[model samples]
Every structure is written in C-alpha cells, then in structure tokens.
Target: KEIMQWIDSENSKAKVQSSIHNFTDMCWKKCVTKDITSNMLDTTESNCMTNCLQRFLDTNINVVKLIQAAQK
Candidate 1:
C-alpha cells in the first residue's frame, strides 16, 4: 500500500511537470513572434507570456472547481 501511494505521488509529480512543459511551449510559441536575438525577453513578449500563463492557470482552476462541484 505504501509503495502504491509512492507511485501515485511520483505519477502526479510527473504529470504536473509535463503540464508545465506543455504550457511553456504553447505560450512561448504564441508570444514570441520575433527572432531570438538575445537571451532576455522584451517587454511585450514578457507580458504576453505572463498573461498566457495566468489564463491557462485560471482556466484549469475553473475546470477543477466545476468537476469537484459536480462530483459533490
């Protein structure tokens, strides 16, 4: 039982990491339109990525809440 719980915990961590990677890739492509000349992101690109990440998180939270409400 302990091993099963540990496996579940690891799987959850992996899923979260995968979600973060996917979100980063999607946001980067959507926000970064110009060529990558420098290591730092410009103001517009930075704001775009921030907004994109916020929107994704907000949407995810809302979905989870709705599912929880339905289950209850």
Candidate 2:
C-alpha cells in the first residue's frame, strides 16, 4: 500500500509538471509575437502570461470543486 501510494504521488507530480509545460508553451505562443530580443519579458507579454496562468488556475480550481461536490 505504501509503494502504491508513492507511485501515485510520483505520477501526480509528473502530470502536474507536464501540465505546466503545456501551459507555458500555450501562453508563450499566444503572448509572444516578436523575436526574443531581451532576456526578460516586457510589460505586455508579462501581463498576458500572468492572465493566462491565472485563468488556468481558476478553471482547475472550479473543476476540482465541482468534482468534489459531485463525489460528496
């Protein structure tokens, strides 16, 4: 049982990492329209990425809440 729990924890971590990677790729494509001239993001790109991440988190939270409610 402990080994199974550890495996599940690892799988969840991997899935979270994969989701973050995919979200970063999507936000980059949507926000970055110009060539990479600087090491840091400008205000527009930064805001866009922030908003994208916020929306993603919000959606995930709502889904989780809904799932929990349904399960209960």
Candidate 3:
C-alpha cells in the first residue's frame, strides 16, 4: 500500500510538471514572433508574451465557469 501511494504521488508530480512544460511551450510559441536574435527580448515580444499568458488564463477561467454552470 505504501509503495502504491508513493507511485501515485510521483505520478501526480510528473503530471503537474508536464502540464507546466506544455503551457510554457505553447505560450512561447504563440508569443514569440521572431527568431531569437539577441539575449534581450524586444518590446513587442515582451508584450506578446504577457498577452499570451493573460489569454491562456482567461480561457481556463471561462472553461471552469462553463463547467460550473453546467453542473448547476
């Protein structure tokens, strides 16, 4: 039982890490408009990254709201 619990805990951690990685990759792809020419990001690229994160979070919120409404 303890071994199974350990496995479950590890699996949950892995899933969360994978999700974070996926989100970061998706956001970067959506935001980065040009090739990385230098170490510092340009203004547009920076703003795009911020916008991407905001939209992503907004979408998650909307989905959760829809689910809650459906449950009720």
Candidate 4:
C-alpha cells in the first residue's frame, strides 16, 4: 500500500509539471513574435502573451468540465 501511494503521488506531480510546461510553450509561441535578432518584445508581444495565457486557462477549465460531464 505504501509503495502504491508513492507511485500515485509521483504520477500526479509529473502530470501537473507536464501540463505547466506544455502551456508555457504554447503561450510563448503564440505571444513571442520578435526574432532572435530583435532581443526585445514590443507592446504587441506582451499583449499577445497575456491573452494567450488567459485563453489557455479558459480552455483548460472548459475541457475539464466537459470531461467530468462525460464521465457521469
């Protein structure tokens, strides 16, 4: 039982970490428009990043609800 509990805990942590990294990558791609040479983000990039993050969170919440409903 103890070993099983440990495995479950690790699995949960890994899942959360994976989700965070995925969202970070998705948001970065959507928001960061400047080329490597520019080295600076303009107002547009900043706004895009913020909007991307918000939209990502909204999508996650909505999906979770849909999944829960389907389970029922």
Candidate 5:
C-alpha cells in the first residue's frame, strides 16, 4: 500500500512538472517569436517567462478556490 501511494505521488509530481515544462516552452515561443535556437534570453524575455508562469499558477489557484466555494 505504501509503495503504491509513493508511486502515485511521484507520478503526480512528474505530471505536474512535465506540464509546467510544456507551458514554459509555449510561453518561451510566444515571447521569443523567432530564433528559438538562441541560447540566452534577454531580461524582458526572462521577466515575461516568469510572469507567464506565475500568472498561470495564480489562475489555477483562483479557479480551484472558486470551485471549492461553489461546492460548499
């Protein structure tokens, strides 16, 4: 039971991390818009990526809260 629970937890973590990576890749493409082969991202690019990730997580949290409230 414990091993199965641990595997499930790890699988969930991996899925979330994979989703975040995919989202970051998308956000990067949106911000870059060209020469994705470029190595280093500029300050604006970096900031945009950060904001994109933060807002994505924030939106998810807000939605979860709204769903919980509706359920209650």
Candidate 6:
C-alpha cells in the first residue's frame, strides 16, 4: 500500500512537471512566432522566452488558487 501510494505521488509530480513544460513551450512559440529555425535566434527571442515562463507561472498560480477555492 505504501509503495503504491509513493508511486502515485511520483506520477502526479511528473504529470505536473510535464504540464508546466508544455505551457512553457506553447507560450514560447506564441511570443516568438517569427523564428525561422528550431531555436531561439536572438536577444528578442531570449526575452520572449523569459516572458513566456513568467506568464505561464503566473497563470498557473491563479488557476491553482481558483481550484483550491472551489474545493473548499
């Protein structure tokens, strides 16, 4: 039982991590739509990437808070 619980916890953690990565990727593309290559090309892209991460994190926090409130 304990081992199963541990596995479930790890699974949840992995899912959350993947979700964050996906959100980051999506926002990066939106913020850097002009990139001609598979990689970020310049300081503008670098800045966009940073902004993408910030937006993802901020939005995730708000969504989580709403979920918690609804659960109450």
TM per candidate comes to 0.75, 0.75, 0.65, 0.61, 0.72, 0.57
lDDT of 5 by residue, 1-72 (tens): 999999999999999999988998988877776566668998888898888888888998999999999999
- Which consecutive 10 residues in model 2 have the weakest lDDT in total? 50-59
lDDT values for all models: 0.96, 0.96, 0.86, 0.85, 0.88, 0.83
lDDT of 1 by residue, 5-27 (tens): 99999999999999889999999
Candidate 5 weakest lDDT stretch, 10 residues = 29-38
Steric collisions counted per model: 0, 0, 0, 0, 0, 0
Which regions of candidate 2 are displaced past 4 Å? 59-72
Off by over 4 Å in 3: 40-51
Tens digits of lDDT, candidate 4, 10-70: 9999999998888778888877755755766677877887788788889989999999999
In model 2, the clashing pairs are none
User: Compared to the true structure, candidate 5 yields what TM-score?
Assistant: 0.72
Residue 56, model 5: Cα distance from true site in angstroms: 1.0
**Pairs of residues at least 3 apart in sequence or in different chains that clash in candidate 3:** none
Cα displacement (angstroms), candidate 4, residue 47, comes to 6.0
lDDT-based ranking: 1, 2, 5, 3, 4, 6
Q: What digit string (tens of lDDT, one per residue) describes model 6 on residues 1-72?
A: 999999999999999999888977786677767837765357877787778888778998999999999999
- Model 2 score (lDDT): 0.96
Tens-digit lDDT track of model 2 for 1-72: 999999999999999999989999999999999999999999999999989989989999999999999999
Extract clashing residue pairs from model 6: none
